[model samples]
Target: MRMNVKLSPEMERFIQGKVASGMYGSATEVIGDAIRRMQAEDERLQAWHVAVRVGEEELDRGEGLPYTPAALDEITEEAIRGMHGNAPACRDVLP
Candidate 1:
C-alpha cells in the first residue's frame, strides 16, 4: 500500500538507520513493523480499559471482598501464572 505521510526528522533518521543497519529492507518495511506494533498495543489497551471499567462498575455496585494481602497475592499470582515463573513481577524480568 503506497501512502504519503510526514515523519519527524528523528523518526526519519531512525528508520534510515534501521535500513542502513540491515534490520529492514526499506523505510516502508520499518513503517509497517511499527504500524503492526501500534495496532497490537491498541488492542491490548482496549482490553485493559474494559477490565478496568468493569472492575470499577463492580465496586460501585458494592461487590468484591475486603482488601487483604493474601487475597491480593492470589489474584496477582493467577494473573501472572503464564507471564513468567509461578509469580514473577514484571520488574523481576528486567533485573
Candidate 2:
C-alpha cells in the first residue's frame, strides 16, 4: 500500500535516526511499529476503563475493599510488581 503522509521536520529526523541506528529497516517499519504500540496502548486503556467502571459499580453495591490510603498503596504496589513480572522483555529496556 502506498500513501502520502506529511511529517514535521523534527519527526522526520527522529524516524530517520531510528533507521540509521540499524534497529529499524525503514521509515515505514518504524511508523508501523509505533502505530502498533499506540493501538496496544489504546486497548489497554479501554480495558482499564472497563475495570474502573466495574470497580465503581462494586463500590456502589458495597462489595469492594474498604477505602484506606495504606491499603490502596499496598494494592497498587502489588499490582505494579505483578505487571513487571509479567511484562515482556521490552520492559527491560527501561532502568
C-alpha lDDT score of every prediction, in listed order: 0.83, 0.85
lDDT tens digits by residue: candidate 2, 1-95: 89999999999999999999998999999999999999988877777788789989999999988769999999789768877896654432332
How many angstroms is residue 87 displaced in model 1 relative to the true structure, after the best TM-score fit? 12
Name the lDDT value of residue 40 in candidate 1.
Answer: 78
Report how far residue 22 has shifted in candidate 2, in Å.
0.8
Best by TM-score: 2
Cα misplacement distance, residue 58 of candidate 2 (Å): 0.5
TM-score of each: 0.69, 0.73
Off by over 4 Å in 1: 75-95
Taking every candidate in turn, the Cα RMSD to the unseen true structure, in Å, is: 5.1, 5.2
